[model samples]
Target: MTNGPLTLMQQTSALRQAIRNQEHTGPTSGLATGAMQGNVVILPKEYADEFLMFCHLNPVPCPLIGVSAVGDYRMPMLGEDIDMRTDIPEYYVYRNGEEAERCYDISSLWQDDMVAFVLGCSFSFENALSQVGLTPRNIEEDVNVSMFESSIPTKPAGRFYGNTVVTMRPYTPKDAIRAIQVTTRFPKAHGAPLHFGDPSSIGINDLAIPDFGDPVSVKEGEVPVFWACGVTPQLAIKNAKLPICITHAPGKMLVTDLLDADLAVF
Candidate 1:
C-alpha cells in the first residue's frame, strides 16, 4: 500500500489514486504536502441546503471548498477525476447522529439524495508555517494534530448547531504570533487561531485527551495555540440528528489538486 518516496506533487496524485484503489488507508494529515486538503461531510439533500447556509454563516470554522450536486460523487471543481465516494482515505458513517461504521469507501451507501461538501482544512496552512521555519508539532511527532471542543459557539442553521472544535499546535508566544499571521492568509483554510495559552479557557479539562486527533508534546515555554477546526461540522451534524451522514475520519482529509498558494488572500 506504500509507494517508494515520491515528490510532493507525485505523492499527492498517487495518494488520491491509492485511496481510490483502497491501498493507502489511513489519516492524511501530512500527506500531499503543499496541497489543499479538505474536511469531508456528506449528507442527504434534505439537510444539504441548511448545512450550506451554516457554513456560509460560520466561515471561519467551516470554510467551504467544494460542494457536489445531489447524488454526485465526482467533485470536478476541487480536483481532476476526483471521486468523493473513494478519494478520502477513510470515512465515518453516522446514523441517528451516532457513528455506524468506518470504511475506506462509501460507494455502496451512495444515495440519489446525498450531497458531498468539502470544507477547507488547517493542513493547508501547515505549508506556510513550514516555509517560515515553524513546523507543526504533529508533523514532528508523526501523529494527527490535537483537537478539542471549544466553548466558542457557532451560528445555528435549522437543526445544525454546536460549539466550535479547535485544533492545537503548541508554540512559544513569539512563534504563535507568527503562526497566526501565516494562517490568516488562507481564509478558506480555517484562518488564524481562535485562542491560545490555557486549554481550560476553552472548556477542555485535559490537555492529554483530545476530542479528536493525537496529542503531541508541549515543550517548556511553549503554549498551546488553538485554531478553528473543520471537525466543528461533525459536532454540528451530530446535533442535527440527521437520519444519515458521512464524514472523513479525523486526520483523514480530502486531498485535492488545488495548490496551497491559491488559497492565500494576498
Candidate 2:
C-alpha cells in the first residue's frame, strides 16, 4: 500500500486501527474511500429481533449490513479485525430514550447480552458520486453531512418506530439526475435522492439549521437533494426507550472491510 492518502480502492483495516487508537475521532465522511461505511446501533439482545425486523420493514433508512453475535464486539461479517466497541469514530450512549453521553469508546459499557447492528451508509456511495463529477456539497465543504428529521414515516416493527431522517446534498438539477443514477446502483447505500428542491416538502423548515451535523452552503443554483440516512435509527432509539441503546454519532461511521463495489447492483 502507498504511504499516502487513502483511496476508493484502499482497504480500511488501518483506518479502523487509527479510530481504535483515538488517532481520529471526527465525521468519517470521505475517509476509507472504497470500503463500505456503516451506521451502528448496539442494544440489549432482547431488542435485537425487533430491530432486525425494523430494518427489514424499512430498508432505505436502515439497510441491514451486518449483525454481531450477542455480546461480541468483533464484527467478522464486516471485518476480521473490527471491534464494534471502538471502530466507530464516536458513539452516543442513550439511557431510556435520552442521549446520556458521547464517547470515543464503548468498551466500558458493552454488556454480555448486547447485540450490534450495522446499517448501510450514504458515505459508501460518495466516491461514486465524486467519480461522476456530482460531488455532494458536504463533501465539497468538508463538513459532516447535514441531516434532518423528515416528515416521511417509516414502517414500524414491534416497538421500534419513527419518522425517517435524511441527509442533504446540494446539486444542480442536471447533477442531481446523474447523482441519482450513480447512487441507484448502490441500493444498500440508501439508493438515490428521496426528494429535492423545496425543504418544506419534507418538513425541513430551514436549510441553515440541522438537527445533526454541520450545515454546508446550498449554492444559489443548486437545489438540496435528500437521501434516507442510517441515522434514522436514532429516532427509533428515542421512541423505543430501551434501558440502554448505543449508536454511532451522526456523520461518524464504522469503516468496514466490505467493499463499496460489493454493495453495487450494476
Candidate 3:
C-alpha cells in the first residue's frame, strides 16, 4: 500500500480503526471512495425474524446487504474484520422504540443474542454521482446528507411499520435528470429520486432544517431531489416498539469492504 491516504482499502481500514477506537464519530459520506457503505440495525434474536421479514417487505429503504448469525458480532459477509459492536462511528440506542441515547461505542451493551443487519446506504450511489460529475452537495460541503421523514408510507410487515425517510440533494433540472439515470443503476442505494422540487409535497415543510443530518444550502436554480434513505428502518424500529433496538446514527454508516459496483443492479 502507498504510504499516503490514496489507497481505498487502506483508507477504509484506517477509518474503521478510528471508529472502533472512538476517535472518529461523524458521518461516513465521501470517505473510503468506491467502497460500499451500510446502515446498521442490531436487535436481539427475539425480534430478528420479524425484522428480517420487515426488510424483505420493504426493500427500498431496507435493502438487506449483510446479516450476522445470532450471538455473532462479526459480519464476515460485509467485512471480515467488522465488529458490530464498534465498527460504526456512532450508534443510537432505542428502548421501547424510542431513541434513548447516542453513544460512540456499544461494546458494553452488545448482547450475545444480538443479531446485526446491514443495509445499503445512499453513500454508495453518491460515489457514482461524483464519478459522473454530479457530486452531491453533502460531499462538497463535507457534511452529512440532509435526511427527512416523508409522508410516503412503507410496506409493513408484522409489527414493523412506518413512513419512508429520504435524503436530499439539490440540483438543477438538467442535472437532476442525469442524476436519476445514474442512480437508477444502484437500486440497493435507494435507486432514484422519490420526490424533487416542492419539499412540502412529501410533508417536508422546511428544507433549511432537516429531521436528521446537516442541511446543505440549496442553490437558487436548484431543486431539492430526494432519495430513499437507509435510516428509514430506524423509523420502523420506533413504531415496532421492540424491547430494545440499536441502529447507526442517521448519517454514520458502516463502511464495508464490498465495492460500489457490487451493489449496482446492472
Candidate 4:
C-alpha cells in the first residue's frame, strides 16, 4: 500500500490479503471502516455446545454472528472466501487455561475437530458513530480500543463462566447521550454504554491501565464510557480450562464483507 489513503473497499481487500500473506500484524481498529468486524473463537467441537450456551446467557457481550462447520474454515454467512486460520491479524493460543503464544498465522495449529465462531464486535458500530460526529476516542487517536475485565460476573453455562470484559471510549456528557442513542440502533455491536462516569463503579481501577488494547486519552471534559466486549469469551475460555482454544487478539478482529448498516435495527 501507499502513503495515500485507501478507500473502504480497497482497505478491506488490502488488509485481507496482507493478513493472509502474514505481511500485516497490527491492531485492526479504524480499518475497513464500515465492515462488520468480528471477535473469533476456535475450539474443539466437544466444547462448542457449552461455549455457544454461554453466549446465549450473555447476549450483550457475546452476540454471535457467524459459526463455521466442524473442521471448516470458511464462514459463508459472514463473507466470501474467509479462512479462519489466517484472516485475523493476530491470534492468542491458549492451552489448559493458560497463555500459550501470540502469532500472525495458525495454519499449522488448526485441528480437524475445531469449530470457529464469529461474535459481534464494538468496532462494527464505529462507522455510525463517526458519521454522527461522535467518533470513538480510539478511532480519533488511531489505537486499538481499551478493554478491561470487570467484576461483573457472567451467567454460567455448563462449564463456561467468567467476568464480563468491556471496551472503553471517552466522551463528554452530552455526546455520551448521543452516543447511546446512535449505538442502540446496532444491538450486535454492544447496544449502548454500560457505565459512563466512574471507572471504579465497574471494578476498573484506572483508565490508563487497560487489560487489553491501547489506552486513549480521557480529556478534561470527557468521561470514559464502557461497553460489553466480545473478549468476555476469552475469560470464559480461561475459566473452562479446555485443552486448547484459539481467539483473535484483542482489537484485532475478523473483518467481514457485511456492512455495518445491514446489522442496524433502524
Best by lDDT: 1
Model 2, poorest ten-residue lDDT window?
5-14
**Candidate 1, 1-266: lDDT as tens digits:** 44676766777788899989989888777677888999999999999999999999999999999999888998998887899998998999999999999999899999999999999988889878988999999888988889899899999999999999999999999999999999999999988999999889889888899988788999999999999999999999999999999999888889998888888887
Predicted structure 1: lDDT:
0.91
TM-score of each: 0.94, 0.93, 0.93, 0.92
TM-score of 4: 0.92
- The lDDT values for all models are 0.91, 0.89, 0.90, 0.89
Tell me the spans in candidate 3 whose CA falls farther than 4 Å from its real position. Answer: 1-6
Q: Which ten contiguous residues of candidate 1 have the minimum total lDDT?
A: 1-10
Ranking by TM-score: 1, 2, 3, 4
**Residue range 1-266, candidate 2, lDDT tens digits:** 58896664444777788899999898777776778899899999999999999999999899899998998989998888888988888999999999999999999999999999999988778888888777777888878889899999999998899999999988888888888889999889999778999999989999899988889997778899999988898899899999999999877889888888998997
Candidate number of the best TM-score: 1
Error of 4 at 255 (Å): 1.3
